[model samples]
Target: MIPYTLPEVLRLVWSLVWQQIVQHAQVVAWSLFRRHHQAVAQVYHYKRRLALNTS
Candidate 1:
């Protein structure tokens, strides 16, 4: 069996954690991008209605 030292194990875990963080950030970014475009389309269809609905 291959033996892994402590720092090696820690580095591996850290890499996995960073990957998850990056993936979550990508999902949040895509969601915000979609919402921004949706708001833009709403403005084209209903300018004042969108503002009124938000307020």
Candidate 2:
């Protein structure tokens, strides 16, 4: 087996760490977007229901 030098090992580790960070950020962003969409939808539905009831 070929031995990896220190720089190569560090580079590999850094890449893996960066990939994980990017993945986590993506997950967080999507979750926040979904939550906001759901909240907006709920508010819209509530308003529609209220308007219908009062009519």
TM-score of each: 0.44, 0.60
lDDT of 2 by residue, 13-45 (tens): 888876555588899999999999999999999
Question: Candidate 1 residues 1-55, lDDT tens each?
Answer: 7899999999998888765555888999999999999999988879778878999
What's every prediction's RMSD, in angstroms? 6.8, 6.8
Q: What TM-score does structure 1 among the candidates reach?
A: 0.44
Which candidate leads the pack in TM-score? 2
Error of 1 at 20 (Å): 12
Candidate 1 has an lDDT of: 0.87
> Where is model 1 poorest over a 10-residue stretch in terms of lDDT?
16-25
